[model samples]
Target: MQSIERAFDLLELMADAGGEVALSELAETSGLPLPTIHRIMRTLVSSGYARQQPSRRYSLGPRLIRLGETASRSLGSWARPYLAELTEATGETSNMAVLDGDQVVYVAQVPSQHSMRMFTEVGRRVDAHATAVGKAVLADLAADSVAQLLERSGMRAQTERTITSVGAMQDELARIREQGYAVDDGEREVGVRCYAVALPGAPAGAAISISGPEGRMTRMSTDTLVPLMQRLAEKLAAELRTASHGA
Candidate 1:
């Protein structure tokens, strides 16, 4: 158990560094002895989970791709039916996204039947402060973490409606938390509007959203969208819980 914990700690340290670290730095950052870190690194490298660079630095290796693929598949499978239901009901693009640091990455999506629908490919990432799904998930995070993420993300505006001020964003997040979902009124794109709800479970960063043009989205009130989004989130949560139990 201790060995596993130590190994995970080392891997986390490397991940926090955006995937690479020097041997000495890894030991220092992980608070493990150099010899111990070296031994574990060797084991990880041998197993293809970590790689040693030409400069003797360490980074995540090819085996981590297998793990990532597994995770993506699990998330996608869990979200597929829910996204489909949402799309069918709303006739809008429905997407499942998760916070990846300061960005929201689309993990799964169900496209709209309309010919002129929003185009968001799976695996595409967008600024947290500028998107509904991003804000919805961010509102669930700690305030300090939110601040740190905003600082890291630079508060860049994707459109005229995008929130560029940290204070304004904080106020907006507070409202989103109170309302139980987030709304982007053409914030990320000129005519796109979105409504999002955060998923509750192991990966707290997960979120589900419905997006369409402002002409359609603006006609609906938050009271209307919130209930639908909450119900969908609950359904997804229930599915994830069942899957976990089965696993």
Candidate 2:
């Protein structure tokens, strides 16, 4: 048990250092003796779960990707039915995305039924600042974290409606949080509008969105759609919460 705790402490220390740790740094961070850390690091490196850099620092290795893939698969499987229901209700594209760094990566999507629909492939990645789902999740984060993410993302305008100023984006996020949903308003792509609702208790950066062409989505009354969307979101959220508890 003590060995396991030491190993986890070392891993956390390395993660906190942005994925790399020198032997001395690891020992200092974990409060473990140098010899103990060296032995654990040797085992971790030999198992391909950690790698030694040319500078002799250790970092997370490719084995973590397999664990990430497994988690992503579980997330997608749990979200699929909700995505289908969303597509059926709105006749628009429905997507489930999780924030990755400063980007929102589409893990699953239910394509629109219309002949002329906005098509985004699964596994596509978009700037978090440019997408409704991205904003919905970002709104839940702290102001400092949001600022850091924006700085990392570098606001690149994708369309005429994209929010270009940090002040403007902050104001928009405030509104999104107040309304319990986020709107794209043709921000990410010309003639495209998106509406997103964040799922509470989700792993950070998780959100769901429905998107369609502005002509159709903009013309629809929010009074009519908002209630329906909220209901669906509630149901989806409940299911996700239940599944998470069971897991």
Candidate 3:
């Protein structure tokens, strides 16, 4: 059990370090003795759970892709009911997304009942700078960390309103933090608007969003949706916590 815990901890540390790190850096960050970390890393590398790069740094391995995909599916399943409830309440499409490296991956969605509706298929990956859910996830990170991530994933403007400058993104994130939510007004796609809030205490960097046509998703609607979104986020977070403990 101890060995398993140590291995998982190292894997999480590697992910937090942008998916790659040297042994010395891991040791410094984990405060684990060099020999223990070395042994664990060797086991991981041998098991195909980690890869030793040419730079002698360790990175998350491809074998974890299957596990990640399975976990994402499970998370999506757990989120469906909440998203359905959100869509029912707001009469707009709702989605759950998680930050994967520098991108946001949509895991689940409940479309609005309206004939004209927004749809972002599950498993679609989008740049973090152009989506409300992405901003909600990024707003929790440090400024330097956010910059490092954006440097790795270039800020390409998806639409005219998409934030393309790092400074502008920083300002946007600051506003998100201040407002306790993020909004994407025709940033990811023209004529669509989205509002999102981060799931507090989620196992990963997760957020939930509501989206619809610009005409319907107005400031007045925002005053109603934001509070409901926040309440649902809190409820989901609490349920996740309970499930983790029960497990």
Structural similarity to truth (TM-score) of each candidate: 0.83, 0.79, 0.90
* TM-score of structure candidate 1: 0.83
- Tens-digit per-residue lDDT, 204-247, candidate 1: 47889999988987886776667887888988887877877888
Candidate 1 lowest-lDDT run of ten: 11-20
- What stretches of model 2 exceed 4 Å from their correct place? 1-46, 49-52, 55-60
Residue 226 deviation, candidate 2, in Å?
Answer: 2.9
Of 1 and 2, the candidate ranking higher by TM-score: 1
Q: Give the alpha carbon lDDT tens digit for every residue of 1-247 in model 3.
A: 9999999999988887779999999999899999999999999999999999999999999899899899889888888899999999988899999998778999999999999999998999999899999999999889998998887788998899889989999999999999999999999899998999999988788999999999988844667788999999988878877877888
The CA-based lDDT of model 2 is what? 0.81
- Whole-model lDDT values for every prediction: 0.85, 0.81, 0.91
Model 2 TM-score is 0.79
Summarize candidate 2's per-residue lDDT along 53-110 as a digit string, tens digits.
9999999878976876777777778778888988898888888888765678787788
Flag clash pairs in model 2: none
Identify the candidate with maximal TM-score: 3
**In candidate 3, how many Å is residue 44 off?**
0.9
lDDT of 2 at 220: 69
